[model samples]
Target: MQSVALLLIGIQLVYAGKHSLQYFYTATSGLPNLPQFVSVGIVDGQPFTYYDSKIRRMTPRQDWMAKSVGEDYWERNTQASIGSEQAFINNINVVKDRFNQTGGVHTYQEMYGCEWDDETEEINGFDEDGFDGGDFTTLDYKEKRYISPVPQGLATAEKWNRDGSLQQRKNYLGTICVEWLKKYLEYGKSSLQKKVSPQVSVLQKDPSSPVTCHATGFYPSGVTITWMKNGREHHEDVEVGELLPNEDGTFQKTSSITVTPDEWKKNEYSCVVEHQGKSVTEDEIRSNKGDSVPIGIIVGALGAVVLLIIIVVAGYKVYQKKKGFKPVNGSDDGSNSSAHTVPQA
Candidate 1:
């Protein structure tokens, strides 16, 4: 029984892979730079930057099958042993047909195929993939069935299932549309791609001096601030504070750190502002307690010192060998310096 289940999963994965479903999976899974929903507005009369929610929240659909089946029905069948399987399968088919009719593919699978019995792969109900996973089943039921990694929040779950089908759908669709438009303005893609930005801010810092750092102009509501000391990340030193909203409907955030002057000189200090799983922007300024020389000068100085020491040691050894001195033999007078003697003595 389990073997067939594994086989089906393998086959679906292959189908997903052969047709490049992995890309869709990854695109949906939060790959940077690909594209995702974001927010946009004028902050202090200036343009706001992009934002991505790594895991988009789930919402109920306008035509959610669970709702159509009735809340009472859903709650009852949701926990039933064999009935749950039937209900789940039925929802899968409904979602499949809906997406097909709309000329779109929701989630990763082309069509969700549910099992009627453990042994035989049979047809059942289904739901749309792009919508919130919450709309479909109870939190425990979802964990047991969908195998989705999205965290289940009590706040979302409490009201999501109880709401009317149309209400849930409107709420779900509206928020997603708003997010989608925001992304359209920012990334110009429907889904967010996972990729790192090429631009890196160079920071100034003294190896031995301690300095304070802060950031302004962010949607303070959903952002976090952290410090990267000398390229090494230090999460412990982070101080997150309230996000001060701007007059134009945007937000601003600030983060700070204090370290000794010596640490700053040897290591770089970077202020990383993070939202979701990606770094929005990292502003860095550099200072040095030792000598404010170009990196090239530091490298050159170290190299010169090493070379000089090697040359001096090499010259002394060469001079001794040239004079035919015996290193281990003592002079006849027993002086400290070793002496050379002819083979005949």
Candidate 2:
């Protein structure tokens, strides 16, 4: 049983290679006049700045965002896709063709994916919109009847189960994903120039409240945020959040620790932000601190500065080396679909 499950995930990671994939496919067009549903995709969970399903056209993020696809061309492609929605849905037959006994009704479904996190050496998590909407049944390598509720959460799981042609299509999707990223990197190279040294702020809910460290508007999501006291790293009462998208194409994360007023006043609590190979200790950003660098200062003679882009590939080799998973990369918890829309079994 485990072998079969492992084999399945193996196929997906093989296609994904190194980059993490965030894809969405939707075809919910009930009315006659509304624009056809747009299938959006993201390379690393950011907006699908380049590709749209209507034309299957991929371009640099700048071109796509600037209407380079053109108003006339976009409308023509959109209308064509809207007309083909039924056929597209038929190819997959996501409706009556159930994957498991899980049950529920979901008209408008979504697909969410988080392929690999190289920094953490983990395969993040998977979300297949409204696939089988229910709980699960377990079977060991011994006698699990079938993967009833399809494990669309694994990113590659859905496409692997499809026909050979479809599977190939998915594989190519991953390949093209890398190309799209490379284009964006070249087009928006300067977006990487602004280095806003993290400004760490601590907020307590109330007098007797817990403390939260907020670091926002920083580029290249490699910043390691941790709570420290008296020069020691503390994880115990620290609830670190995943890096989330900020409006300005930067990233934000929060780590909090519970402390009483006494500890808060002791001035021993500080948040540490490690970015671009330098470490800065933020002592609640009180008056004792000033701007690291005005951020506007020119660095013509400052020599080379390395900035990491927000993409996920560092997992391909490790994923291959470790088989499907390792104890450290999280468990094979099963191709379980926590879909809230899986119909009642």
Candidate 3:
């Protein structure tokens, strides 16, 4: 019985260890870092670009410097095509559809290169030290802005500049970013994706019930958490909720917006959680916390019964030994001789 008990305990510990290991791996590897980039237009309505600022840091001399050193030039000369919004949307939908048709994974790599603006070109002459004005002392154009191709597995959105050059959209730096985005998109489809995928929860409440957003993520501590009503970033009229740690060591947060009972009745309320780097959501989950003490009590009761049985059995064995135990007598007869002998004559 003792052996059996030990075996059972060993088995339970093994099972628990296996479960813990599995959960640890899942929490660590199952999700991808959310790709952060702005969508150009609607997925099915326009051809837009997603420029990854994270990638831009790679060639800081060109990509990073160009933006800051030539901010005005890049902004001014950067052409905006409003008419192509719908066209861009349509193209992206085609790509999405093609991805669906493939039935497995999708791989797409896009490369974009564009010439720096005139003003930026002129500034190339100035080094960390100010240079005196002279043609001989003028700067050299050592760098050309090139966006790396997003490898084979990730879906990306980007824009083409007016001169047929690549513009900033989703910046695909290389393998790491590409792999990260692939995992990210995969999670997005399954409603598990974070990193830019907005955490959305649908609550059936008064149609006028205001919904608020709360956030905390890989983003800096000071990031802003805001509310949105019907998709507008809310400013003045909502309440924010507390931030908590996620099961995966990331962060989970909540916020609420108030409207009216009427809004809630319509079931149109949703909680949108946005942290700096990623966001997750919780909606009307259709369930609440569960009770556990009943099972615990039952287990405790059974353990007590076993312990009592062990104690009672041990006591009975000791009692039986004491009842049958006798001291050796010198005479063969069990009765004492004093009882029968005539005063020891």
Candidate 1, superposed: residue stretches over 4 Å from native: 1-211, 218-226, 265-267, 272-345
> Candidate 1's residue-wise lDDT over 15-117, tens digit each?
1001110000101122244322211111111222211123222112122221323344323222221222233234334444433433332222111111121
TM-score of 2: 0.51
Best by TM-score: 2
Backbone clashes (count) for model 1: 50
Clashes within 3 Å, all models in order: 50, 17, 42
Candidate 3 per-residue lDDT, tens place, 111-188, comes to: 111111122321111100000110100111143222212321122211222222222111221122223222222323
By TM-score, rank the candidates, best first.
2, 1, 3
TM-score of each: 0.25, 0.51, 0.19
Q: After superposition, how far is residue 111 of candidate 1 from its true place, in Å?
A: 31
How high is the CA lDDT of each candidate model? 0.26, 0.37, 0.21
